[model samples]
Target: MVWTVMPDFEGYDEACSQFIWDLPASYNPAVDFLRKHENSDRVALEQAYPDGRREQYTFRELDELSDRLAVGLADLGVEAGDRVAVVVPQKPQNPITHLANWKLGAVSVPLTVLFGTDALRYRLDDAGVAVAVIDPTVRDDIDAVRDDCPALEHVIEIETNAPAGDVHAFEDVLTAPEHTDIEPYESTPDTDTAILYTSGSTGPPKGVRHSHALWLGRAAAAYNFFDQGLGPEATVWTPADWAWGAALGGTLFATWHHGGTIVGYPASGFEADEAFDLLAEFDVTRSFMPATALRLLMEVEDPTAAYDLAIETFAVGGESLTPEIVDWIAETFDSVTINEFYGQTELNLVVANNSNWFDTRPGSMGKPLPGYDLAILDPDAADRGVAERLPTGELGEIALRPHDRSVFFDEYWHMPEKTAAKEVEGWFVTGDLARQDDDGYVWFKSRKDDVIITSGYRVGPMEVESAILEHPDVVQAGVIGVPDDTRGEIIKAYVEAAEDAPAHETLREAIQSVVREHLAEYEYPREIEFADALPQTTSGKIRRKALQEWDAQGSVDEESP
Candidate 1:
């Protein structure tokens, strides 16, 4: 399954420019890939792990499974446009159920495993989900709230253990024979594909709506630019879930559309060595992960030399990547090739620094992707018109207007007020704050909502944590604004030390010194605490709100956040 560098259609600049240019009318992403392998025996899915266990589904096998599942759903009166809430961990069952729903033209509402009962209930109710596909761990929670969810009529369990009496098992559909007379449902490009829930730190998570057209448009753009150019066939490995825009928009959708095989670990979650082993074994051509995971891989020292393969691109997103991490990947993997992209749940990748052609500037998230009109606007200044783009070097809210492109979200599901708040005229305001440099590359700082203001100085917690992470002693860290008597807010950091380091005052002072030297005086952490681990979502980003709440509740409600 390994692939080496072959005939490339476009160079770096051309591929980067064309990926943006060819986005408007590309095919629908969901069905395109499935269609390509309908009549073939190509390994459509290689869902495997390093521990000598796996599930391999050929293209035809996958298509048939989707068909039978669609029939099973139809037999239960599941109709097109019905919202099916899926609350499952990272497993193969997730994708199988998702594609089945897609085949039936059903709208999927994917909830993260980290969600508590309240969060899950809100999403289920908000999206008017009638049926749920759940893992065993959360079956009791759904049973607890089933009465309140009037729209929710069925609970299909995808569990290793037996569930409560009224619930049906997910295996029943697969084990049963397909309905031969079932008519194939035609899904158009504009069909409502999914409603992915956003993980909002402050308020209720908004469900971002996307159509088949928008989904396919992103895949087409990737194929025409970096993908097809790299190789006609590519093997992609990513831990990206269907819920995240980057995973749904970038990896799985794009890979499938290009007839590429997905070589993922067989286990529920990712391990550092298993990932490397999979790449080496499959000759994985393209891979994607966050900078956090990349940092872990960098610790291996000579990772590429150890597991050699032709990795055409290393795509990263979810947070701002550090210069050291990018440098290590280039030296270990390839130079001028770490493609860092910028995006949120609300929008797909509006900007990207592609590995094909453009020169990467370490920490900078490259210029706006073609077709997206990116602007940095000062959210603090109300009088300033929407057209007023902030001067280069000044921090502002990152806004995007898709020009000559049909590749953006339809709207936030049932949350019109929140949707209006994020959009200005025609542009979508990515809650993230960033600044454009003189060279036109954008530099990410912090979330617009997560900004900390102390006295008169505005401080970004990312600046503090980014510097704190540099100290060899720290394993994980989260920086948040804590209310103070003197300053309105002061920087307080909760750090998880390396496995061997102890949580002591001396270590805290040393951590503070690291931040003070690397960042501005105001951006340094004034208070620090050493903990076993910092709170993180299923996606692994440090959850600052959880930390802020811990600081508010006297740190005793350590579990509250």
Candidate 2:
């Protein structure tokens, strides 16, 4: 299980100083992660259920199952370059479907099970998915949208008592006796492997297309950030939805690319206790969780004391990491640093706090990764092809060099206009607001759409949210701009209090004072509201757009300013 390409570095500086983006012309991730280990009996995946049930699949077994499924799919008219939609939970079947699609040189489209009929149908119609591997639990949702998806010809059901007349049983595809010795499909490294839809915070979800070479490039994040190497007995687990790029690329693809084992669980309704139990039982060495989940885990009484944790490297993404939670993790876990990574669904892992290479600075998203050239550019001037790079300490949109194919996405599926909008000359605008320091550390501010403008002053929600999180009574915080006739737009803060914390005027004033201390007076939240919990996406990112919508409708119950 040796890697074909080895990073030439002993430390962070050496790695970044001499980085190379060498990849083979013809590459298939299935052949690298699964076929290369087909003769070995080492467990590739361990599926743990909330009810304490566990299932282990060796590399050999998974390889054969994927081969059989690939053959069965071919028999059903699925060919190279076809889109195969996978709508399921985080389980063996999800990755199994991914492997099977790659084996056929087909593209895999991962759809979250949380998506309703409209969202599911929109993606299916958008991608022109030819076949779908779906869980029976979402059969009704799929059925409601199937008529609208003209390209969808086959439906494969997983874990069902009875499938519809036109539907194929998933178990039958894996166990089909006629296709046990099928050869894997051959594809070039640049062949598209997967299309992951975004969370649609600003608009409808866009299909992000990544090639096989791009998928293999995820190994850099593993080797540099997670300290994973060939033949390491590392077990990785993440509670993020498989549909999101964070879990799909960070945990599943990265772990397997390094020949490490992956741990999967039912990710629909994730419970902190169950997650901790699985991590302890499996002795997971590398773990990735969203910032929201980490905050929730901290709410549990002495989680590290209750569960025997073997986690050596813990990474978080999808949102800003507060200094308070970072301190809590440092104190709770022995010799573990809460590594932070910054990237979007379009570009995965551009900047990261690799504890193996450099020390982490709390509240910073660290430096740009090797093989990527990142900069903060003026968002207003980007479209005119005059995107000026901002100096250090000035907030602007994050953009990456487009020529770096190893780290950048190919396009937004079938939307060339949208893809063209993201690029300025040779730079791919990330649409995320951030600023860099003289030390080369990138400080994430907020999404360009999430920035607040109040009284001729620009405010980033992350800075204010980070300050609000420092309060002893606050657990989660979300900030947005509400319409104000006087100031044009006023800063509004939504705070989720800690357990047993009183939500009163005194506490609100204290929270406001924290923001006032950290930022300018105009940037401080003028309106404060208390909520039991903030709305979050499936990937655990706070839905600030939802809050903005609520404010637009005047549905928010605001405390006196």
Candidate of highest lDDT? 2
Write down the lDDT of every candidate, Cα atoms only: 0.70, 0.81
Off by over 4 Å in 1: 1-30, 37-39, 49-51, 159-164, 175-184, 220-232, 266-270, 301-310, 334-336, 381-385, 556-561
Per-prediction TM-score: 0.89, 0.94
Deviating ranges (above 4 Å) for candidate 2: 1-5, 175-178, 228-231, 556-561
In candidate 1, the residue pairs with backbone N, CA or C atoms under 3 Å apart (3 or more residues apart, or in different chains) clash, namely 12-356, 12-357, 29-216, 48-265, 48-266, 49-266
The pairs that clash in candidate 2 are none
lDDT of 1 by residue, 352-450 (tens): 776555667766778876556788887764223364578889998888887643457778887787766767766677767888988788888888788
Each model's backbone clash number: 6, 0
1-561 in candidate 2: lDDT tens per residue? 236435657776787778777676677888787766544588888998766688999888888888888888888988999999999888788888998899888999998898888889999999999999998778999999999999999999998756867888888766466647776777767788988888887787889988886666667765666754334488989888888787887778777777789988975675778778888999998888887778778777888779999888778887877777778888887887678888777777778877767778888899888878888998899867776898888989899873356567889988999988987878888888888998888888888888788888888888888888888788788899988998989989888887778656888999889988977888888888877777766666677887886677666534311
lDDT of 1: 0.70
